[model samples]
Every structure is written in C-alpha cells, then in structure tokens.
Target chain A: MGGDFGPQVVVPAAVEAAREGIAIALVGDEAVVNAELAGCDAEGLDIRVVHASQVVEMDDKPADALRRKKDSSIQVACRLVKDGEAHGVVSAGNSGATVACGMFVLGRIKGVQRPALAGILPTEKNPVVLIDVGANVDSKPQHLFQFGLMADVFARDVLGLDKPSVGILSIGEEEGKGNAAVREAFDLLKKSQLRFIGNVEGRDIFTGEVDIVVCDGFVGNVALKLSEGLATSLGRILKDELKSSWLSKLGTLLSMRAFKRFRKVTDYAEYGGAPLLGLKDIVLVAHGKSNQLAMVNCIRMAATSVRNRAHEHLVEKLADHQGLNGKSEKSAA
Target chain B: MGGDFGPQVVVPAAVEAAREGIAIALVGDEAVVNAELAGCDAEGLDIRVVHASQVVEMDDKPADALRRKKDSSIQVACRLVKDGEAHGVVSAGNSGATVACGMFVLGRIKGVQRPALAGILPTEKNPVVLIDVGANVDSKPQHLFQFGLMADVFARDVLGLDKPSVGILSIGEEEGKGNAAVREAFDLLKKSQLRFIGNVEGRDIFTGEVDIVVCDGFVGNVALKLSEGLATSLGRILKDELKSSWLSKLGTLLSMRAFKRFRKVTDYAEYGGAPLLGLKDIVLVAHGKSNQLAMVNCIRMAATSVRNRAHEHLVEKLADHQGLNGKSEKSAA
Candidate 1:
C-alpha cells in the first residue's frame, strides 16, 4: 500500500519473500491488501496481515504524519518493531515520515546524537556507504562526526568489511578545503581510531577508494540524486545512439550479453534499500518506485540487519571511540 | 604553459584559434612558449608571446598565489585584459589560482558583491549552468541570490537561453525543502521578476528541467566532481564488460559509430571552460588536464564573452533586481 505502484507491486513482492521463508507482515488497509493478495497462497506461508486505518501520502510532512496518522501503515509497522513483534521494518513510503516514526517509536541507539540514513551505492570495486543522505540537514560538526562513527560500524557489519576506511566528503582532498562544518568534522574524524582517510572529494565516492563517505544529509542527498539522474540520462542517450543506425543495432544485438553485465553492475535494484543507522531497531527505506526485485532485496537486507545485530555493534563502536562531544552515552532526543 | 600538457596542448590550440581569426596571446615563460611555437606556423598567425617570470603551481593556496606570484602566467593573462591589451583571458591552470588572479587583477564588475564560477554541464535536453562550482564555499544567502541573477544573464547571453528558469538546488523540490541558506534564497528568488522555478533537487540538474541550478560553491563543486567521476567509472566498466567476450567485441566494432556519437554528446571538451562570472574582464578556466580541443573551445568561449558583453549585462541586471545585499556595488577586496 506504499509507493507509486501500491499493493500491486508490494503484494507480489511480499508473497515472493514469504515463499522464500521470511516472515512478512502486511500492514495496510485490510480490504485493499486482501484484494491484491487474492491470487496468492497466503494461508500456508508465514505472511500475516495487520490492518492500519490510515495512510501517509508521499508528500505528507514528517511532523504532520507523526502527529495525525497514528494508525498509518508506517507508524504501525514501526510499532511492530518496538513491541518485539517484528525484528526490523521495511518501507517504501515517504522517507521523512519513516524516519520520524522510527525515531518516535523505537528511538535512537544509547549514545547516538543523530540517526543517519546510509545510502549504499554500487562502485567499480565494491559498494560504498554514504551516510546522512537526506536524514539530518543543517547538521552540526558533532553530528557529522557521529555519522562517521555510525557508518564505520555499518560498513563493517552490514557491508561485511573487515575495516572500512571512512572518508569525509569535501570539495577537495586536502584537510583545509571545506566549509566550517567540514573543517571541524575533519578534526574530530582525525582523532578517531577508525580508518580515517582524511578528506575526499566527490570523485572518490564512485571510485571505491573508500568504504564509507560521511557528509551532511543535504550534500549527501544531492550527490545521490545527481548520480541517479546522470546514470539514467547517459543510459538513455547511449541506447538511442545505438538504435539510430542499422550497424549499431546489429552491434547492440551481438553485445546483448555484455550489456546485461554492464547493467547489472550499475543497477540500483541490486543494492536494495539504504538503512537508517544509529537507531535502536533496523529500518530500511527502499526507493518509492521499487519493483519486485528491489522489494525482495529490501527484505533480504532487513533480515540480514537483524541477524548481524548491526545496531548493537554501532552502540559498542561509539562507546569505544573517543568521545567527540565529550560524552558518548548522550541521546539526541 | 598551464595545465598538465602545458604548451604541448596550449600552443596548438592557440594556433588553431589564430587561424580562425581570433587574436591569441600565449602568456608563460617566453622560452617554453616559443619552443612549443616552433612546432607551429607562429610567424604567419596572429599569435604573440607574453613572458611571465613565474608560474603558480596547482597546489598553491589562492591567497598565497595572489601575494607571491605577481608575474605568474595566470596573473599576466588577467593583467593583459585589465590593461586593455586583450578583451578576454583563458587559462587551463589551477582553478583556485585562476580565480584569485581574475579577482585580484581584473576585479569584480560594478554593482557585484561576489563573483562566481559557472560550470556548464551537458544534459539530455540541453546544457544547464551550475553556478559557483568552487568560487564561494562559505557563501551567504545574498551571495547565492546574486549568483542566480548573474547566472540568468549568463544563460541568456552565453548559453543562448531566452529567459532561463533559475532553480535553487535543495534536498527536495518543495518550496520548504532546503537548508538555511537555501530557504532564505528561496524567498529572495520568489520576490524577484526573473523566471524563477522555485526549488529543484539534484535529479533536476541532469534532467534539464531548469536552465540554471544555483547553490553555494561547496555543493555545486561536489555535484560537478561526482558527475565527472561517475561518467568516467561507468565508461570504464562498460568498455571492460564489452571486451570480456568475443560476441561483445564484435558488437562493439559494429557499434563504433554509435559509440562515437555517444561520446561526443557526453564529452566535456564540447562544452568548453566554465566562466568566472562578475569579473570586470572575461576570464575562463579550463580543466587542468585540458587537451587541444578543450583549449580551443576555451579560447572560443573567451571571445564569445567579449562579443556578448556578458559583464556589462551582469552589471545592469544586478542593479535591476531587488537589492539582495541592500547594495550590489560592494567589493570583496
């Protein structure tokens, strides 16, 4: 009942995940979800339906959604996590609302100053995590330093890295080439015990030179959206150019095998959803227009987060690192 | 002698521009410039060598470059324009050094508070201008508002757009979506008479939805470098994937023409160098690794700025718009 395709896509995806032996909870309007699930085998699987009386529109403000939509599917899904009925929550609904509900219901980790959204993007070498990718704008230096600590744990636990090299995103590779927030954050990052690689420019994100890139939510979000837009535009232009001539058409036909590999390497669907880190419970937010494959990947990601106990690792890592704010156990809210 | 290839690429490009009836000045160590000129028909062309005693290294700080390297080639080129010996200046040198030289030697135009660098990028629909790509990192709200005004004129006269719709880059497309700097800029843009299109996210930059996307230099620079890195990485991956199999290799051979066209469409050489806006005299800075084609385009862009009188138009436009800083005539230095 979330996203542009609503239950038409979500129902099929949830059914597929259920068949794969993952416990699934369909939290939405009963009648609407039932009508979509009529053709599926829901009885023999571990899928359960939990009705929610309200819905949060994609454009709904986070504050309004938290206050007005108490029985919204997003809120109900989060409540399930808080009540120990579900290990984690996955939503393709409005991200802002999801973040609000996650914060309001399950709360942040013990020492987390600000919970950040870790956007995992594909690179030539391996996937890299970009933290705070639209979660906390107008971020302070301490918040940014905290983001690096949380992401360092996330990259190791979720991404399965032995030691993730965390790099602060800035305009230049030098320590002195960033704005006020970045300059202060640089100092904090340098003092930490994590594999701090100093300042990295935007070019370093896709080169897979670092395992994690830390930035304020505003800049991180801009980089993510810009990459998406450029990749789509380039793919479209390349396809049109190939189809413009008969020779190129023949070439494209012969190279179909190679194109598949190329597409697989660049596709966002394979990366599933980004996780909201520094939270007490795992919450993954998929693209609003996610297809069945993306949804399945999201389910897999959520289950993996539960298995690894990523939040626990983040809590320990923060406690272990030098206190950037002079206190490690202080909660933001 | 500026850029990685220095006179090896710059000399040929100046010769090509000279043949096309554009007067060219090669500002560098006379011996090095003349050595490269020996490979061309410098005697028959309208090209002259202007000697500068020093060269500013790429890693030099902008302030240091301004204070120490008074006779640097970058400084000499701008001095040529300032002294009425040349109508415009083009340098494939260190961008920070170039910006400093342009500001110090040429100064800002009348009624301009802060000059910006416009990085024009190619999109599927058309080219869009990203203002202040690395000029003003800690930019004020008034600085961004002024950037929009300056970019509006730049798009109209240089980019050939008739009333380009200017959009403020933010996390969301909503009017209430950006950080503090962006939120304040939004109000100023709304009150202005220009074809302001409200807020646009990073996705809109490549979609060509807006003619000009305005942001502080830090964000703008990140977007620019991220795009460059992604394009290069994608290209490398696609090429490697194509060559991995015989079938794909044959296909690539057949689609060579289409691939060429695709490359041409996305190539930065065709777009030329980004202009340093609000300068009293026209100054263009090409990429540090600029080749002959990019240098030629930079020279052509410099000539275009002079013929279009972009600076004069900017002066009038700043005075005509609602006074963003209460006075546009204030200079930085």
Candidate 2:
C-alpha cells in the first residue's frame, strides 16, 4: 500500500514472507491486493487481505491525511495493531503519514516522550543505529534522551548486543561541545543507567566506536542522507575516473566482481527497514524504494522484533527507570 | 603558530606565497618563528615575523583563551588585520578560538547578527558552499537568513558566481517541511532578495543542485564530517575488496593514477581553508592538519577573498536589502 511500487512489489514479497511462517496482513485496496495476490502462489499461507479504502500518497501532508483519511492504508494498518488483530504494521508509503498513524493509532509507550525512527547503517566495524533519523524534527532534550533509551533496547534486543554502548552525536568528542539541545541531552544521558559513552564526533558514527548514536531528527536525517550522498558521489567519481583511461577500462572490467562486494558493504538497502521505536507495538518503516528482497528482509526483521518481545522490553525499561536513579554525572569516554 | 607542524610548515609555505607576490606576516613566538624561517630562503620575500608571547592550545576554551591569551598567535594575526597592517588573516589553529578571536578582535560587520564559517566543498558539478559549519551551534532564524545573505556574497565574490542560488538545508525539499528553525529561516529567506530555492534534503548537498546550503552549525558540522567519514570508509572498503582478489589487484594497479584524480575531487584539503564570514576584515580558518600546500592554498584563498572585497560586498548587500523588500513567497523548486 506504500512505496513507489505499491501493491505490485509488496504483494509477492508479503506472500513469500508469509510462506516463511511470518503472518503478514496486506492492507490496501482489496481489489488491488487480490489482483496482485492472484499472480503469486500464496495458497494456504497465513496471508490476509485487509481492505483499506484509501491510499496515502507520498506527497500528502501527514497531519492532513491523518485527520481526513481515516481508512487510509497506513491508518488502517495501525488500526489493525490497535484492535489486537495484528502484532505490528509495516508500511512503505508516506513515512510521515505512517508515523502519524502509529502515534495516533497505536499510541506511545508509557512515559515515552517521542517515538523515533532508528536508522540502521552498515559501518566499518559494526552496524550502528542512528535514532530519530527523520521522525520528530524539533526535539527537546528529554526527547533526545528518550531516543537513546529506546534505541538502546532495540539495539540490545533486536541487534543481539548484550550491553550496547551509546554516545550523543555532537560536533566534538568533549563533554560540552554541542548545541543547546545536545548539551542538555548529554547531561541527561550521562545521568542514566545506559552504557553512556561521552560525546562522539560526526566522523565517529560510521566508525562503529559506539553501538548507538543519538541526536535530534534534523541532524540524524542530515547525517544519514549526507553519508548516502557522499557514497554515491564517490562511486560516480570512481567510475568516471576508471573509465577515462584505456588501462582503467581494463581495470574496471577485471574488478566487476569486487565492485559488487563493495556495494554490499556500503548500501543501506542491504539492511532491513528502520524500526519506529518508543511505540507500544513494533512498527518498521521500509525505505520508499524498497524492492521485494527489502520487503522480505523488513518483514523478517519485524518478526524477529516481535518474537524477541522488543516492545515489551522497551516498556519494562521505561517503567523500571521511571526516575533517574543514577542522576550523578559520570564522565566517560 | 598553529596546526600539527605549526611554524615548521607555516614558515616555508609563507615564504613560498610571499615569493609568489602575496605578502606574508608570520606571527608566533619570535625565537621559534626565526628558527623555522632560517630553514627557508626567504631573504628577498616580503615575509616578516611578529613576536607573540603565548600560544593557544587546541583544548583551551574559546572564551577563556579570548579573555586571557592576550598575545596568542591567532589573536595577533587578527590584530594585524584590525590595525590595517594586513589585508587578511589565515590560521590553521583551533577553529572555535579563531572564530572567537575574529569576532571580538576584528568586530562584527554592521548589521550582522552572528559571524559564521563558510565551508567550501567540491561537488560533482561545481564547488558548493555550506555556511555556519561549527561556528555558532544554536542559530536563530534571522541568523540563518544572515548566513545565506553573507554566503551569497562569498559565492559571488570568492567563488566567482553571477547569481548563486541558496537553499535551506532540511529533511525534505518542500516548503515548510523542516524543523522549527529551518521553517522560520525558510520564511526569512523567501522574503529576501536572494534566490531562495525552498528546502534541500541532505543527499542534495553533493548533487550541486544549489550553490549555497545554509544551516546551523550543529547540522552543518555533522554533514561536513559525516561526508568525510563515509568517503574514508568507502576508500578502505574498496581497497580491501579490490585487494582480496588477484583480478582486482590488477585493476587496482592499473587504476592508480585515476585514483589520484578521484582523491583530488574528494579531498577537502585541496580547496584549502574555510572563510569565517560576517567579520569586518577577511579571516580564513584552515584545517588543523594543514600541511605546507594546504597552508599556501588557504593563504591564497584568503587573498582572493580580500582582493574581491567580499566583506564590503556583504556589507553593501546587507544595506541594500535591509528591510524585506520582497516578502512575497514565490514558490520554487
């Protein structure tokens, strides 16, 4: 019901994941879903076609669609979770609309300030989780601190890290080196129970020095997209250089296989969807250009979250740490 | 006086630039500057040394250093500009301290709210300018607008553009799609005489769609360093993948010269220093790791800015468009 391909690519991927024993509720136009499903061999699989009358276009305003399009695919998907008919909802449509629906329909966890998107990137050492990549643009210090707390649970439970270390994304590696929000958030994290490392510079994000990097949505989104842009620009520049010379043309021909391996390490699409943390239920937002493989991977990742009870752990973590027990600042690196 | 090599590298570069017809005033400890100056044949060049009693370490706070280190090299360099003994000042020292010294020593230009750093980056098509990169972290709306105002003058003067289009850095390209500060800044830019191109996403920074990208120092710094980190990581990944196979070994060997060209397009040091804008006089802040060539390039860049009278043009533009003469929002891409 979302993304560029809409039901065309999603139907088959949902059927495939359903075949893999993950129950997938396909929410979109009933006619469109059934028509796409007819092409796939989804007989006897745990796949249900939930009729969503309206579709949220990518350009639709989030608040506008949330207020008017009650039966929109994204809204209907979230309603499935709210009504206890589904464990979670996955949408590739309007991310803003999806976030709105998740917040308005599923509601946030107790004491959670804001539900944020945890973007996962393949780094040099390990995959780093960047919280609030594009959700909740104007964040407060408390919201940023909550981003770290929620991302910590997701990283530990879903990513299988026993005790993930966290750092605030800032301009420098010093204690007092960021904007007002980051400075305040640093104070909050330093007083928490998380494995809080001191400040980390922007370059430290992909180096995987820490498992989790926390920042407001604006900076996180910029970091995510800037890294993607740089990688793309680098590839284009490398290819142009390699093709300009006859010797390099031969080099390119010989190194074709290695180029594929390089793409695997740099491509963010190789990973599944980014999880929308701080929500009562597990909702993952796949990339807008997600293909069948990506959809299947995202569905598989969501199933892992559900099986591991990541949301419950997040809720418990919130309840257990209602008040800052370790409010004494700890200077760490 | 600054950077890793300090006077050792600065002396030879200053001598070379001075020989090339740019006057150089080497400011640092008299004995250390003389010892380094003795290494180079700078007798006929217009290279003079000024004695400075103290040096500002990288770890020293900007405010503390500004208030205490009276004769620091950076302060002395800025003082030379203020006293009209030098046209411009260039330092590869602590950037925060440099900005602080530039603000207090040289004083802010008339009608300028905050002084900022304009970082130049080489994109696929042309070099792009990112303003307020780690200069002032918490920027107000009017300040972001002023950054665009000042950087527009810089792109036209130093970068040599007729009409450089400006865009506010945001999570999306639509109007009113960013955080609170960006949304307000968008409104301010739209009302100005500059060619405001609505909002630009993070990945668009390298695509060269717009000439100037304006944002606060926090997000701008993240974008700058994240791109550098990704480029470095990509190089390492490509080398590892290419060397793992004998076929790619041949490819890597043949494409060595082309790789040098790739480095030139991506290496930020090739562009030399970033200019700290909105000051009464020209002040360029070079990278801390600037070598001899980088120092010379930075000095040359400063000279270019000085010769073009970028500061005066900025002041003029600030006057001609003081009030919002064009406040009507013209929708643009």
Residue-by-residue lDDT tens digits, candidate 2, A1-333 = 889888898999899899889988999899989999999999899999999899889899999999999999889889898999999888888888888888888988878878999999988888999998999877888788889899899988888999999999999888988988789888888878899997888888888778999999989988888888878887888888888999999988888887887677677777768889988998899988888888888888888899999988988887666665233112211
Worst 10 residues of 1 chain A by lDDT: A324-333
- List TM-scores for all candidates, in order: 0.96, 0.95
Model 1 misplacement above 4 A:
A327-333, B327-333
| Per-prediction DockQ | 0.81, 0.69
Those runs of model 2 whose alpha carbons end farther than 4 Å from true positions after fitting are: A325-333, B325-333
| lDDT: worst 10-residue window of model 1 chain B | B324-333
lDDT of 1 by residue, B34-90 (tens): 999998887788889999999998888888989998999999888888899999988
Each prediction's total of clashing residue pairs, residues at least 3 apart in sequence or on different chains, is: 0, 1
TM-score of the second chain in candidate 1: 0.95
